[model samples]
Target chain A: MIEFKAAAVTAPDSGVSILEPTTLTLTEERISIIGANGSGKSTLARLINGLVLPITGTVEVDGLDTVKQGAKVRRKVGYLFTDPTSQLIMPTAVEDVTLSLRRIIDDKSERTEAALTALEEIGLGGKGDVSVNALSGGQRQLLALAGVLAVTPEVIVADEPTTLLDLRWRAHVGALLRTLPLQVIEVTHDLDAASRAHRTIVIDSGAVAFDGDPAEAVKFYRDLMFGRPTRTADA
Target chain B: MISLLGIYRPGTTPLHKASAGLKSLMLLLTVIVTMMVDDPVTSVGIMCACLLLLVSTAPPAKATLRAMGIIMVVAVLTVSFQLWRGEVERAIDVAADLTAIAALALAISCSTPMESMLDLVSRMVRPFGRILPPETIGLMFALTLRAIPEAARIFIDARTAARARGLERDPRAVLIPGATRTVGFALQLGQALHARGIAEEAKPERTEKKPRRDRRSEKAAAKEHAAAQATADAETSETPLVTYSTTKPANDVAGPTTAPEGNTSAS
Candidate 1:
């Protein structure tokens, strides 16, 4: 379970508010966070993996404090970035996954075997030797996911993973994410994708505007976007 | 894409099985031997032999030639300068020597996996392990190898984006975003490393019973550890700005103006 105790984020240099003090307990298996660009939804997802440290209160994953026990917290939570190029740090797909298992499997040959297995599990079995730069965008995303899964993290926090993918790849990746046994907390702009989540949270202007059933959350987000012009101009 | 260093073309040649250390040593010997022999005929003969050896490895022909293109330019420049100085034998010797070394280096790099080379790096730095963590040094080497191609891709993408706006000639437009995106890439890589626990795992454990190195080594190790910590802190602190600026929409109703870099179509 992930818990945020009045956690808030502000720009370290500018001191501008990025996230308001918000408390949330994300225990659902599939939770979607939907909001406008820069609406703090990404900030919320980042907090779970300790990517963006909260300035106000504590954020914990399974009782491990994100600030104090960051490495441990990260071990339990894997993060998927919007860009796979930035996420994949190795030359080849297998090498990238082998890097994740470096600390786990000390034996070199055994580690390579395990990495190949992980790739096979992700449907990238024969492409292990392929350079990451050669793979298509969708394949690169899948390779990134394979790297994340190699660590065996209990929860996967994906931030707009499918946003860059084409329609077909978006469905392919979305279906893959849905089938994973691990808890998934995804932040996305796709309302239809948001509706598939068991629970959805709507963030707006650095705060949670609505949080509950997926359908109702989507309705609230849509209404909030459409109703904003009349309520507040130049915002 | 142009192939750069550390690009291993899988093959079953003897060069592929040779240890990186041995290959590096051989390369050094070849350089020294070639320099010792000033005869143009011998140098040309050695250069032909090296080219033959490289071909025996069966590397990707097109990528290897592209990688060697820069070396070819350098060799041409050196030969031209010598010829202009009215030294015919010297020009031939210089050209052959350059080709010989370049072919050997390319052969080794193409046949050997980067991980093995990194392992050699770690082993070479083992003597300084007391002052500097060998694993950390090896990790840095690996990251550097990975960054070159990534940086090239970033610059090309930035140029493409600039051309799309017909601003390709404007240095500011091309360079500013390129620099920012490179920095963002570094920060993201740092986060990925930290999240994967690689940063933590790179530091070797010390036992209380083990004898301490000298005071200078201890201080150096502490300094290295502190620098790594500062980098991690900076990554976390500076990451919010990247996220905010990239994801921020131009208009309140419209979505973000641009997607993240490298949003290539899958078709």
Candidate 2:
């Protein structure tokens, strides 16, 4: 479970709030955040992993405060970036996954085997030894996910993971994300994916414009994007 | 860069069978020997042997030639500069040693897997785990290997972006953005490593004199060393039991990246 206690982010240079003073508890099995560009969806998602620290207020994962207990919080929260090119740092796919397991499995052979297993589970069975640079966009993302899951984090905070993916890969990755047993908090533009989450939050201009039912959240996001034709600006 | 480093081609040649540690030690010895030699004739002979050994174990003609072609240009420039300085004897000596060492290094890199080398290094430093964890050391090597190709990619991307914006042939436009992106990549990598909790737990101790081995421990180590050498000698074979493709894979294929030369798979 993630809790935000009036947590907000302010740009150091501009002194503008990237995320408004907001309080919310995220405990759903799957929660989606949908919003326009620069609307603080990524900020909110990063807050879960302490990737984006709040200037004021507190953010906690379970009982661990992200600020004070960041290392401990990060251990329990895996972060997936929009680009796997930066995330998968090892020379090869299996080596990358093995990196996550190095602390867990001390023996080199054991770690390698475990990493290979993780890769296989992520639908990259024969690609364990492939160069990270050679992997297709979808494959690289899958490898990144495998690397993250190898550590077995309790919660995954994904920031627009499917933004750079193609249609087929988007669906493939979406299905995989949905089926994960652990809690998932995803920031994305895919309305279809956002609609299928247990709960969804819509951020508009750096504040949570709507939160609750997934369908309602999606509706609100669409309305905000295209505007509601039935209502006047005053309404 | 992928073309230069971590560019281990998969093969079951005799060089591939050599242990990374033994190969590394031999490479050290080769460099020391080459540097000590004053006679240009001896240096040339040794350099030729090194070149031949490299060719015998190397990949296809085209790729090896391409890599060597770049090296050749550098080698020629160095030799010419030395000659211009009125140091003909020094020129021959330096040029010969340089070619030999470079070939020897490439041979080592082309045959050994990166993981194998990293594992060997990590275990070599396991005794220093208290001051610096073996895992941390291993992670350092992994990061170094990852950084090479990543930096290359960043340069390519930055250059491409510059060209796209009609800034072709402008070194400042290409280099500044390339350097900035590379630095950004490095910073993000540090953050990623921290996020994964790879730092500060051990609170790395200050570098100091290595702990001396006790007399008893030294005797035991000698015994262990003898046993390991005997086993290695018995296992050594010139035959290539494992078949591998001479043709290169279009994509980075599964196999060892770089190994220290002479094919001994260290236990």
Best by TM-score: 1
Candidate 1 lDDT by residue in tens digits, B80-123? 99999999999999999999998998888778776777778889
lDDT of each: 0.83, 0.79
> What TM-score, to 2 decimals, does candidate 1 have?
0.82
Q: Which candidate leads in DockQ?
A: 1
Q: lDDT (0-100) at residue B70 of candidate 2?
A: 74
Alpha-carbon runs more than 4 Å astray in model 2: A229-235, B9-19, B38-45, B48-63, B76-96, B116-138, B200-267
User: Candidate 2: global Cα-lDDT?
Assistant: 0.79
Q: Over the stretch B1-267, how does candidate 2's per-residue lDDT look in tens digits?
A: 166554566677778889888878878999999989988999999899888778767654665667778778888999999999999988898888888988887888777777777777788889998777776787788788788878888898988998899998799888998899899998878767766655434543223333433555455545555555555655795533222222222222223333435632211
Residue range A1-235, candidate 2, lDDT tens digits: 8999888888989989898888999899999999999898988988888777888778889988877777778789998888887787766787778878866787878988999999989999998756677789999899989988998999998888899999999999999999999999999999999999999998888888888889878777788888674222110
Point out the worst 10-residue segment of candidate 1 chain A by lDDT: A226-235
> A209-235 in candidate 1: lDDT tens per residue?
888889888877887888743222111
